[model samples]
Target: MTDPSRRRVVVGVDGSTESRTALRLAVDEARYRNCLLQIVRSVEMYEENPESEELDSAVAFVRDDLGFTEVSGLVTSGFPAMALLEQAADAELVVVGSRPRSAIASVVLGSVGSAVATHAPCPVIVARTSGERATPGARVVVGVDGSDVSERAVDFAFGEASHRGTGLVAVHCWQVDHPAAARWDAEAFATRRNEHLRWMSESLAGFQDKYPEVQVTTSLLEGRPAVLLTELSRGAGLVVVGSRGRGGLVGMLLGSVSQSLLHHAYCSIAVVRPVVPSS
Candidate 1:
């Protein structure tokens, strides 16, 4: 049973290498936040020793090997994505792993990672590699597009940066199709570029004030948002983006840029949805 008194970090465990990676990250994060790590696995309940064996060993690994005492695990019955979502309702964060997909899906988030990232109640971190760990004082990057969802992402990024004692890179990317346009419509292009820079500044100003210790930097680039962020992810400890963005149509849950980063980011990616208030 989940102890409601203790804050929890939820993770999906499938006894795969990727799941083990997710478990490691969850343990690290839960320890950092002083929260409980709840590892949940989905099974039909009739499976024999290997399933039980894996779960038992995973628990022991967390307790005896990892030395995290506040660890508990359970086997629930349902599909992987749905079961994980049900377990994550009260969790502070949901962590999941992504396997390398085929060439096409490689450019987008995998099926399970996509579903959970879009619908999880809280922020979701999609772990891409088994060994990419955020080092001390590493940088967290977030893309802002002047939307409500982007605002939430910025807030989450600031908090994460502060928690990790790292810096925040707030990136805003704008596109100019041709170099000739810059030479031909110089003033217009300059004005538009200035506008983008101002928007990035305004978006980060309040966060900077609130998280005074988190060193914040701004990246205003004239390129595709997804491409720029992908390049930026090479040096980032974590890359964050909104579930849906200014380019997405109404009611769309995930944006193209966010989806792209989930597949291509070098480090962990956090997909944050805007909180909806209750009635």
Candidate 2:
């Protein structure tokens, strides 16, 4: 088990533009946290030796550019996702660049980012390459749905906000199904919405109490969870969500909100997974 007192951050590099951005972000984060930075590069079976050479150059560039004196580099041979997940075992946070290919062609969260986020022993950050800048006073946003997994996500978001000295926002989205021919009932809908907002406020009270220093905001929206989260992420420095929730098969891989937000969210996203229930 990783000691909570020790500071360690792991970042994956793949010689892409996105990967370079991730390296920079990782270095900055390490400096901010005063932690040891570990650069991990993975090589698949079909890749040639030149990939390793490129990785070496990339590592040197990161070290020189970031001026990080305490850094470690590792080159491993295996599936990229699996190797990174294994390395994340002892890390406080795992950072990876968003895939370079188109969203349709690319594996959304199925690649290194998604795989590690789902299975890693720690929080995983998926850094996007859209050239979005994190505003100085930007808050960290987290989605909550009253599930155990969401509670874990709330814990991570609170910890991160405290660590970064930023504000935290908790968002809950609700949807009310209606028949195709049914008329909209504005009054009744408003009453139900108010109740949901109250519930959300109560549910997030613990997080606010735990991190009193961190500013907290609670929002209740009427729409799809993923859509609301994507919209909220526009002004956030980081958005966090749970991997699996109170949905279908508990043993299934990734949850729906995590899968959708991973592909569509604008800013960096952290997908938190609960500890697997013991048999």
Q: Candidate 1 — which pairs collide?
A: none
Regions of candidate 1 where Cα sits further than 4 Å from its true position:
1-3, 44-48, 100-109, 130-136, 176-181, 247-251, 277-279
lDDT of 2 by residue, 22-70 (tens): 8887887787678888888888763667877867777788778767767
State the lDDT of candidate 1 residue by residue for 1-279, as single tens digits: 556698888988878877887888889889777788888877765366577677778888898988987888777766778888897788888999876433554644456788899788788998766234556677999998898889999999998888888889999887776778786998988888898888778878888899899999898887788889988887577899998888665345778898888877778889988766676
Q: Which run of 10 residues does model 2 get worst, by summed lDDT?
A: 100-109
* Candidate 2 backbone collisions, by pair: none
TM-score of 2: 0.83
Off by over 4 Å in 2: 1-7, 31-34, 45-53, 99-110, 131-134, 177-187, 248-251
